[model samples]
Target: MRSCKDYSAKIPNVKPALCEAAQLQDSKARSVLGRPIWSRDVQAQGAPLRVLVLGGIHGDEMSSSSLVFHWIALAQTPPSDTPVPISWRFIPTLNPDGMFAKPARRVNARGVDLNRNFPTPNWARDARHYWEERTRRDPRRWPGTQPLSEPESRFLLEQIDNFKPNLIVSVHAPYGVLDFDGPSVPPSRLGRLYLDQVGIFPGSLGNYGGIHKGVPVVTIELPSASRTPQEAEMRQMWMDLLRWTTERLGSSASTTPASPDLPKSP
Candidate 1:
């Protein structure tokens, strides 16, 4: 329930223009830990919707991270027209500390992959160690020396509690695949969107498709390296998502469906 103003003050070096736009919105967005989560709102006018977009869960996936940051930058200006009854909260560059320093790591400075850090009953033992190797023990995927240990991971956990988004998207890259988690999202529509926009095969996030049930989380992987890509592809991904949101899933409001029984660890 934190206001945009509150978040603006919390994140240092937030663009001044963005701060101005946040002031125009009536409601605010908060981070998981009660600090401000980066966000912007244009009144539904009469109808309201909530959408959350996450970037930089993996430090090496800068291609995806850049697009999300671009969206945040856009949110600084009030939309020339009222956007579809949507309240958008964009968490760009979630692990800024890691991203600024490392190119392709998925872990935070403490070396934990935020994606793998989510509490699941069946996470493979030493699963976090895989990330450690990926980063060459760069301290990016060390699993924080414990669970839910990094600020970025904790921030996202809190965002889920506070924003309660109808749809959440996490961007990643180079795999040429789109993976989804959560139970409520229709598999047909979710896969179609990825195949249509990026020509990537579709799959489920870590095969635990029902971890959070109703809160469908779409993970889009771009064809870019951790740092480079054709500007066109990057822009297209953004436009496709915007179009998908405004046209396809924009109005679909889903709650967190009950977590389903996850498969055994691989």
Candidate 2:
């Protein structure tokens, strides 16, 4: 993984202080090129709710990773007024290899789109068909040889199984819209982006986690791939999320009952 200093040069709007403050831990997972994928767990007083926020699944989305770093800084100081205490796990730069590539491509070193490599239902049939037909075999959107074929995607699956987050927030960019999948009522808006229920893809995290796994997955597509929204905007989005989470998932009286198909996605 790159040092904080390196991040300053690579990612737009990211200062070295932001990376250092995130205090990311080694996830013990690596990309195809052996770059460490880091994770950080932030707490808000008690074990009330759990949220998993992921960014940089696509390397070219520099702003996505930057936003995660900024959120980490914000998460460090939990608001005293908030009622729900959250156990937040953040995976910043899930595709470090792609982020650090010569020109920062969207796929991994093996040229697989990790976003399209989740083990969703009927991945072999649907993923391939989507790639060949729907996407017209777009190389950047390749679903890989099979679902969970790459180490990155497998690590994410393990995180989902182990973390069992009540909600999953996956960040991406340049689309400027918010998407929701799973059991609860979705947030109408986060900052400037409003709820836009884009149809699910065959092997997307939103599809697998939100639809298949039954977890509420909030997908944020920022307005720019390289430029992060203003600091105030990002903070507003965070606060909005906190409010929605507290309303929608505050009652953690019942933890997910585990089974092959017991609890569900994103």
Best by lDDT: 2
What local lDDT score does residue 155 receive in model 2, on the 0 to 100 scale? 93
Ten-residue region with minimum lDDT total, candidate 1: 199-208
Deviation in Å, model 2, residue 208 alpha carbon: 0.4
TM-score of each: 0.61, 0.94
lDDT of each: 0.51, 0.88
Output the TM-score of candidate 2. 0.94
lDDT of 1 by residue, 175-232 (tens): 7666665554433333223533331111122332235335666677666534534446
lDDT (10s digit) by residue, model 2, range 1-266: 36677777888888887888787787878888898888888854445678899999999999999999999898889788987777788998899899999999999999999999998989998999989998889999998999999999999999888877889999999999999999999999999999999989989999999999999999999999999999999999999999999888987524432222112110
Candidate closest to the true structure, highest TM-score: 2
* lDDT, residue 111, model 1: 60
Candidate 2 weakest ten by summed lDDT: 257-266
Clashes of 2: 10
Instruction: Note the residue pairs that clash in candidate 2.
Output: 209-265, 209-266, 210-265, 210-266, 213-264, 213-265, 214-264, 214-265, 215-264, 215-265
